[model samples]
Target: MGLVLGDAWLWAAVEWSPPAVAEFYIGGGFDTPTVVALLVAALVKAALLWLILRAPAPGPLDRRAKALRRLLYLAVAYALVLRYPIALLPDAVDAAFQLALWTAIDVLYLLVIRWRSRMLRAAAGAVFAVELAAMADVLLDELDLPELGSGYIVELALMLGGVAATLITLVGQRRDGRWSRGTQTAGWLSVGVYALVFPLDVFGRMSGGDMTVPVMMDALGYVGTVWIAATARELPAEGRPADLPPARRRVIRVAVTAVAVLPIIALIHPEATPHLTYTGWSMDCYDRPSFGDLKPAERDAAFLCRARSTEGGVPPMFPDSLSDQEILAYGRALCRAKDRDEQRALLTRAGSASARSADQWDLVYVCPEIVGAAHPELLWSTTEAEAANAAYIAEKNAKCRDPWPRTKGVVQATANYFLFVDGDPGYLVHDPEDEAADEAAEQAMGKVYDDSTRVGVTDSAVLIGHVADVADVCLTVKAFRTPPPQRTAGWDQVNEVPIVSRSGQLTVPEMGEGGEVGAGAPMPNLAIAGKGRYRLRVYVRVDDAEEEQHLVVVFPGASRKRLKLKPRPVAGRALSFNSPSSGGRRAVARGAGGRSQAELWS
Candidate 1:
């Protein structure tokens, strides 16, 4: 009784069962059917064991009987302790430790079993010792010994030993004259089943294969336990009655068979259906408003017909009055009628134009007849407003398209020019008075610009500049209309500007101490022949660093006015004049010194 209780508790704690179906019997939290079943089964078995324990003793307790009773108590205690606390250890350690403890308990139980001969006990002991060694290897991660090669050899040896033990035990049981033929045959059969199942189970686990074999072994083990408990008791002396009555024995056998079959049934049962809330198309057609007037059977038939047809299959049963094609057509028409009626009902409840929702507008757009009768002007006005808004956006986008050529360094007449310098705090302009001031200004400028530059476009100009440290600089020039706000509204609002043309890499050498480098010529032949302000933006990059600057040139509608050459800092880089300009064209030079030298000539 103690052994049975302990085994039951151990199995429950570990949840030893088939992988795919184990959840149906042992998983799910409290309140689930499977968990409830397990609790009921456990309580019933516990109650039965309690009744058995309460029964009168058969005879005086011998040393072997006392030892067996103590061992049972010990097994129960060990199981309870491990199940609660010790099982919390790391998986490998917990499994290995549990196996070792169980192995010890099994050896003790075997010693108390009162085997017919010493030879049989010895064989069993040898098999258990081999099993214990294999378990130890598992505990140590297959011994981690190079010569062992994954511990398969040790497992195979243990399997062979188990085979030998099973054969010897069967032969010994057959030869014994103390027990009845029925008992010996049952013992041999149980041993044979175990011998076959155990190896297959071991191999399945080692190879990580399918669990069907292990599940079978578990079922067989349950039956074997019942058989061992029923037949392994000592026989009464000559002319004595059996320990249990014939009727009781038959009842026990029937009960044990039922108990063993329950788990197998649970293991093989189909998985529970997942609970899902029905929504949208999955909602039953019978629940729709259209089905309110129909009879229950008619409603069911309609839903079934629609469901089957929706799945692209013929309905099993159709209306007696309708053909197959007519049934399908009728089902589809009913569904569409219900949808249209429901949509109209919703629009009606939403009231006239003042209270209409987005869904009502959508319905009106698709089926104008539904709401257009009451709110014709509202629908017409909405349609015109949407068309106008779309047209406005399209016109703005058309005006913002790329307005420059694709070629590098090929400046067009309408193209604006920009310049920028790349460094940390960006472009620095210093006006040093003396050599000492120049050195001081150079240090200050170095601290300011460090390793960065500035680049971008303004109202009507493109200013492209580069710092001296930069080895290679690429400038991409893009044009945007500056006046007539509606024409450039889209480009003005967006963060990403459109690229019109690229200047490739304007490769420049490292600046010599006394020499000046021309950044680039002014964008020549600009065709700014419109009333609007035109701007050119230059995207400058020194190596991998980015800088942006812009230059704006306004065309006052063909008026020839002498525009002053005001050196303004555009996008943080100072525009400086190196020499005097007599003609209208401004000749700009980027110098190494800290200051710009400008001479104005008329």
Candidate 2:
């Protein structure tokens, strides 16, 4: 049974990210709110252990009674070791001693508890130890520490205690010649409970839900096993005090434990918003991805504000062509070429590493962005080669811009927009002589680019835009409205919606279809207004197949508007216009030099 419960915890840790357990896996050293929670839990657990120890013990023990006592002590001690492995260890030899200790405990549990299967206990211990060790390794990597940090000693002690208790229970069952009803029930129920509880715990963690739920479940299982075993198991007559009812005492113990742990579990799980804020994009993230792994669609939400908007049954403008990966690669390439150091810094800030592939999008994009600044020679040579390439692309698709830097300083913004491609995204340094040289270069570029005005920094280069002004720039998601055949008079858009910032820095803007945009939602037809440089995110849960444009209309003084896309559905109706430009609508395919770049990575 002891082995079974241990296995339960092991399975939970590996198969699913149990909340408290996940920290250990993610290089537990990256101190976050969750880490703090673990520390607090350790303290609370200690208090509980102290209280349990002080509780009055039932009198003289029969063999079974003796076993139960040992089991209780072992479990409590093991729990402590898990939290503070070095509490009883010497400083220098702590790590080595801890590993040895846990290993010894495994042996003790398997050997001592004759009734409980040895193999099962060993299996559980092996799994648990491996996971803990893995987590410790991650933590060490995060800290750049050469060795696993302290805590193993404590874990070993705790394991030892749990083993002792399991052994005691088996002895009692054997001495009685047959298992008591409660003992038998606990053993069976434990197996089933172990299987179920850990899975639930893992699922909850992966889903990024409240951690409290699973921890509570564990406590409940533990207490339940104890309660069941105490009540149904025949008590050894020698250990019983005639005056006290063992059943009642056991119930009290269970109740007290449950009550004590309730608050502890609550403390372990708190409302956490795992959103990371960075330049250009606001992201709600949990585990940060490796830098290069971020897909283009994810980057799009931050860079271009390409979230789908729904109104009047209008289908959102999804880049029917681009895959998320392609988009991100393109974006990275563009950023990197134009602004190498800064782009590298961005990836680093986002918890990503530098690029290994020169053919990567970051490299490609940077090639053009810094043609004059960093790659002047390449710019001159590539320009001619690019022109030939452009001519070929232009033949295939008029919408495609063959010469990437189509116009001097102009880069195709997407199939939908244009940016000056010739101009460097920011200034770059040629080879720096030393650290001091690098700093000097950065400072010089900072001044040239007006770092104070720029929205972000690219290594030594400034983005050459104000973060606030950048945030205020209106990046519209254009939707062509195709009204329904039957337009109703009362048919007005349910105006309230949000232009969420993916970076998670600013509070979500209030937007709506009509009237004043209230808190939380915005009113449509209004310009998306705000003060900071921010990417807009629009999501339409509604199924409207109408063409509707979501616009981020910036008002002076940092106020912004979220124009709700209220397109009237066109049911199989073909409406032709002389020109898209005639009605002030931007032509998506106006310029023909190369194939139109697809924004959505389909």
Model 2 lowest lDDT segment of ten:
593-602
What is the TM-score (0 to 1) of candidate 1? 0.28
Top-lDDT candidate index:
1
When summed lDDT is taken over every stretch of 10 residues in candidate 1, the lowest stretch is 593-602
Instruction: Give the per-residue lDDT digits (tens) of candidate 2, residues 399-424.
Output: 32322132221111212112112121
Tens-digit lDDT string for candidate 1 (1-602): 31245433434433432233344432332233333445444454454334323322244555655554454444444443445565566667665665656575556546544567777778677776766665565666633543322455665785565445445544544454333443444455455555555346444644453434444454444333332332333222233223456776676566546544544553342334211122123435323222223454454344443422223232222323233344334334333344555534443432312221222222232334544565443344434544543443334233321232443223322211111222222221211122243343334433322212222222222222343233222222322223212222212111111111111111112122222222222233222332232223222221223222222222123222222122222344433221222211111122112213110000
The TM-scores of all predictions, comma-separated, are: 0.28, 0.28
